[model samples]
Target: MRLSNKLSHALSCAALTLAATPALADTVWLKNGDRLTGTIKVFDGGKLVVETSYGGTIPVDWKQVKTLESDRELMVKQDEFTGERAKSLKAAEDGKVTLINGEAPKTVELASIEQIIKPKPILEDLVWKGNVDVGLDYKRAETDTDDYDVDFKTTARHGAWRHNAEGGYNRESQDEVTTTNNWNAEYALDRFLDEHWFWQGRVSYTRDHIEDVSSQRTIGTGPGYQFWDDELGAFSLATLVNQNDYEYKDGGSDNFYSLGLKWDYNRYLVGKTFELFSNGELGKPIGGDSEYELDAEAGLRYKVTDWASLNMKAEKNIVSGAKDGEIDETRYSVGFGVGW
Candidate 1:
């Protein structure tokens, strides 16, 4: 009798624990009489994202939802109102939700909800993503030739400010003679004035080991406009007035003012398995020996997996009408890289 009672008590406790585990999760009912239990991530763009232990992150069509319940304080926006941080969510009638806000529960239609977002800390919600690519070539036996290149770009965003940094190095040697050798780095900071406008400050430096123009530096400030930034793509354009300085190996140097235009664009296609991107700057010297300067690159990235990609791009660099004559070059490269 004692043994049977002990076993019965153990089974009862186990059953209660199993039942309570599911009550901790939010619940959603579909029109097809199916029920889903998970933590609601967000509802945006006609999709409700949920984090589930069984299916990972899943996006459900908003139209198929009958009702939903949550115990989370989520930020929700309606068609004509700003975001409201509700205290919790409780199930209501079909196609309606009860927002528990400590006073009276406000009922809203699901169709009128424009967006739902989880609130995150301002300082703790920084986003960092970047890519690193490398290319190499080597040949031997007849004419000794070697070429190596490395390039990297990173961006970080916090609140209203965006930071960008990129740099690259390239070297080529044929017949024991170095034909091309240079490295450059640049950093730019942008502060958004609003959703579509911003102000920027930037500084850049470049050094060439085997060229007449050995050193170059620039400082600039500008205003910019952002077209759109979302899950699919981003694009921005800016104009700057810059102070440029150039130094030559022939004991010569020049400094002048220039107006420059810059653009950045990227798009994802084929269900985000491929991306197309281009960014560059063009400068017209106001008063200098250099007539026009151009630096640009356009590329395509094919995602092999979530974290790895194959990249191909073409780059052009020119400083025309310089003291050492026109300097023009174009390069094509294929590389392997990783991105986050």
Candidate 2:
């Protein structure tokens, strides 16, 4: 009896292990009758992402998918409806899925499916994400040039409010002669009114060690639109009327009113291993010596791991009507950084 009890306990343990494993629980069927087994990550832009143990993360063509099923609870959106919460999904007739919602199960055609995603839990109310990058160069033979650049950007969101801040420092010298020295910082606050619209208030300050311009300050506020924010990417645009103040080293100063446009955009591709982004603000002065100004950056990040990435960027700063003349500078940098 003792031996029989031990054998029964071993068999029970094996069954429990198999049940706990993620193997082949989620499924996708194609029009050709071929089927794939994996956990569904997301369905966006005509591609269905699935995470498989053997194949890693794979993107399947949405058009060729006949039906799909998953034991995971998900929110499915279709037509003009907000969305539907389902305890699970079951493959139904060809090109359809049955969403098991308690006692009432609903069938939806694959064509009518607009989006499929796991619902965000309330615990995600306070979330933070950001990254830092640096660039350094030195030369010993040609006049002993030394260059340094560092920049950081971060975003925090709580409920309907979002905060963004970015700052950078740059200095270059050749043979103890300072050619460039400047640092700038900016902060912006966004109060989302709804899913798409928001109000933004921002302020920025800059200090320069150059001969002509010594400092700059700006304050602005306006309305904006968030086109989308999701696992794939995010994009937003805003227009602001700004109050600007500038001071030069020779005790010269100027203040002006300006209108500016700002845009922030980013996109992730290929299972989130690659990212493309561009963000900037451009403005035209109304009643001052400055004509137009621009500050922008565009970049690409190749993720080497979840927290580390290799990056390349091009940054541009142009002040068309500075007291000294048109001030234009462009820089290219390659660096590695960590993000979360």
TM-scores, all candidates, are 0.73, 0.74
- Please provide, for model 2 over 251-289, each residue's C-alpha lDDT reduced to its tens digit, 9 standing for 90 to 100: 888888999999999888877899999999999999778
What is the lDDT, from 0 to 100, of the residue 210 in candidate 2?
82
Give the true-structure RMSD of model 2.
Answer: 4.6
Q: How well is each residue in 231-288 modelled by candidate 1, as lDDT tens digits?
A: 4467899999999999888878988999999998888676457889898899999978
Cα deviation at 146, candidate 2, in Å, is 2.8
Best-matching candidate per lDDT: 2
Error of 2 at 11 (Å): 7.9
Backbone collisions counted per model: 0, 0
Question: What C-alpha RMSD separates each model from the true structure?
Answer: 5.3, 4.6
Best-performing candidate as measured by TM-score:
2
For each candidate, what is the lDDT? 0.84, 0.85
